[model samples]
Target chain A: IEYVEEAVEAVDKDKWKGIAVYVDHIDGVIHPVTYELIGKARELAKKINHPVYAIMMGHHIGSQCEELLHYEVDKVFVYDKEELDRFKMEPYTKAFEDFVENIKPTAILMGATPVGRQLAPRLAARLKTGLTADCTILDINENTDLVQIRPAFGGNIMAQILTPNHRPQMATVRYKVMDAPERKDAAQGEIIRCNIDSKELASKVSVLDIIAKEKEQFIEASEVLVVAGRGIKKEEDLAMLKELAELLGGQIACTRPVMEAGWLEAKRQVGLSGRTVRPKLIITCGVSGSVQFTAGMNNSEQIIAINKDENAPIFKAAHYCLVGDLYDIIPNLISQIKAGKTVSA
Target chain B: MNILVCIKQVPDSNKVEVDPVTGVLKRNGVESKMNPYDLYAIETALRIKEKLGGSITALTMGPNQAAGVIREAFAMGVDHGVLISDRKFGGADVLATSYTISQGIKKSGTYDLILCGKQTTDGDTAQVGPEVAEWLGIPSLSNVSKVTELKAGSMVVEMDMTHEIEIAEIEYPCLLAVDKDIFIPRLPSFVKKQETKDREIRVITLADLEDREEKHYGLNGSPTQVQRIFPPEVNNHREVWNGEGSELTGRLLSKLKELKFA
Candidate 1:
């Protein structure tokens, strides 16, 4: 299609009135991402010159619509009920799809999170509209009046998208990357409550249970981490490494290979496949820095690497580099530190 | 599921540079690329949709030039694309960028699954994914290695870790920031270039918004900022070892002994 035709065909909303966004929320614990989407809608509504409203599919998120108003969004649709309290696919997707077909929004934005990731594709099928995921940025074109700009190919490329022939250009945004508008203390925003269809709540998926992972700290929120790779060779040797990590008051960590070798627990893995850590201090032993490995811990404020190989990439990111075998280095340092060695945080 | 994937167009890190005096990146003439990890995220979503039957819409927020990445996404089979461009968004930290993208998605209003690479090669901070999830008030799963099963409204997946696999079934309206192993990305079609520019890239500006609340759009809301950018420092020198395998091992062991590491 020609650019002009593609651009003009996108805004055909005579058949579409408003786009409804589907968000997953549990009671008492409102996900921060929903605020980010509402915040974005506040801005996007102005760009497209359309009303941007948010929809939450949970049992008790109706009270939180006030939070959406903090970002100045136009409206919030609450579909809260006992069966819809927890996230289940069939009912939630059906309800959201029905709402979308009824509201006919120009577009929808969701958090590219676990729930959104699982639900978006299914909802897109229900709505038969395009859905973009994990976009770091967004905006509209004056000439084309389409949403634009999302990164692709592991941040190597930027893609501009538009639902020229479709109503409600759909997309999702990742966390910490999008702007979350503030809630004004004095400002009171209007909240409209709509009666939801009750039949949509009965679905096939069931929430068997909900519990937090054991001994698993949210690595993203941690301040310090100590990682061991091939250098710590033996599972037994990890004891000494743990001893060292103990002195520093940090959690134990490892590379993908170490996890593959069973020297550490899977939760300790730090890399592309593992957790991406942004601790204040990240210490490494025997880990050669690969592009994949670096992506995990490269954000650490202070990096210290002890490796025998002089040419390891870990040295490049390290603030302090010690060249030697880990066997001698670790034990000696552990013993010395145990002997009341003064250490600096 | 209607899935959306977000990727970044960044200067290839290996070729990136910093202005030593200013601690700022020099982007006037550096080569750029789509983050490699994001390729896995997008492809994985596409694969899920293909099996489950859905569509993939790709979007980006950058300068007018960022449209290049969007076109690439289209060729890879994303059904549509969007470009959120505006001068006011320039130099935005993660928080601002998150708000801007959320706004664009809100306006677009068509999505079920949102996918992203764990982090970017440049900032290397994975906070954006979680932060966006926080703002959107949805369930977010990060560092996902594989989407094991997608049944009903629940997603059963494994998070690849250093030691053991973590299997969790997340409810819908969830966000997932993925690792490259999620899926092998599709190759760009040669015809993408021929047909890319022809596709309209929708762009939005600050003036386009009704509220126009400038208090925290860009730098105002960010808690962390790029205080400086520098080439990763390199230290230590190499003592090349040259000899037969036995000799190399013996020498290595001896050197360890001499260094009191044995």
Candidate 2:
């Protein structure tokens, strides 16, 4: 069997229509990343000369579709029902899968989140399409193919991927990677109530409970952030970082290692697996910046990194790099701030 | 009960580097290790084996060298190993990779449960596990953070969806892509490593799979195309300071003050 690359011109490319963004919402509250996807989709739509559409799926989510109109999507498709009230993979996958089959969107963008990560793959399998996950950047080529760029192999390099031969080129963009467009005062978009098939709502998995793992703080809304990583020797070391965050009138966050060590709750971890934040100022202590962590916070207004190893990758991303033991430097910075002395360099 | 845990050998994440000029990854001699995420899946299987008394078969789809991960699984207490290796399977993407693994699983035999890491560190696509389940015609779940109940024919699990954690129950012969911290993954025992040093790893090649259509196996079956590769834009402006701890601390404080952060 010969391995032949499919010609880009082989498919009926013009048959695909609008750019679609999946609206991630639960209990009537939409995830902010949905708006970010809208913002990105708007940009990509302009490049490809297509209207942007938002696909909303959940029980009683029609009102949310109306709200999505404010974000400038040309159309909103709503699949609201009791079956979708809770997210079971099978039903949600089926709903979005059927929508794509019907509407034939040129591209579908989703948040690189747990639900998105889980659902996107299954749908791609069903459609026999291609999907690039955790994308930090999205662009449209002259040929109208969606160029999905993401950090690969532990963030060492960026890989630009394309699904040239497949319709509905899919990519999951990480939260905070793209800016969220402001909602307009008056909604102008049309909302189409999608009639979902009963069979598509069938699920093999049954949900038992939905609960918060920890009391949530809006890390995305924080003005200042202090994050810890593997540099912190033990779980107890998190307290010092937390105190620094408190003194600075900010919240505490961690790299994946700290959360995995049970020092901080997963909600407080700032990385690809966790929440994405764009604070006014972010101070990373003992964090060896990986693309996973940097992708979550690189958009912050200012970044200060404190690590003992001078060669740590965090320095490459930081606006201000401090090479020393965070254990020693943090206390001094805290006491100096308390003393009201100008410590300008 | 019988169990099968899927694992993969990936280039060590920390050692992967890209060439600045060519915009291609410099992969001449990078060392390979069991994917860090797969360790958790193996640990989960070992724990389940402890409670349920099941024989564990660790499986993978890669080159012959991928047998290293299977041996590592044996060091962690897997009873058997299988490496689905063949030249025709090279350069396969997630879709084809999952289909081939499903074919290998069918050839190996059936099991009550199948476990895999949420995603691989290299491909970073968390799709393979669920797609394999799709191929095998079984229910699958992802980001499963915890297992709360294990009944005779069903199991309940807590899935971490980031914003909220949802608990779900599924019947036997299902697939799960487990998340980190599901358990504190135990280190491979030195004693077990010594004992399993000579263990034979069953090799499954193209001839072993039920569907031996070569065209459906590798790059020919992959749909995604790589248009280009490059390094992400980095801020080149950086100031590295080296001094005594106290002096460096003072300098950092002063720098914070200069930036109005103090």
Best by lDDT: 2
lDDT of 2 by residue, B152-179 (tens): 9989999987657899999888999999
On residues A164-260, what C-alpha lDDT tens digit does candidate 2 reach at each position? 7778788888776787786787888799888887866887789888988763477886778999888888887677778778766678998998888
Worst 10 residues of 2 chain B by lDDT: B253-262
Total clashing pairs for each candidate: 134, 1
Mind sharing the TM-score for model 1? 0.46
Number of the predicted model whose DockQ against the real structure is largest: 2
What does the lDDT read for residue A118 in candidate 2?
Answer: 73
> Residue B85, candidate 2: how far off, in angstroms?
1.5
Docking class of 1: incorrect
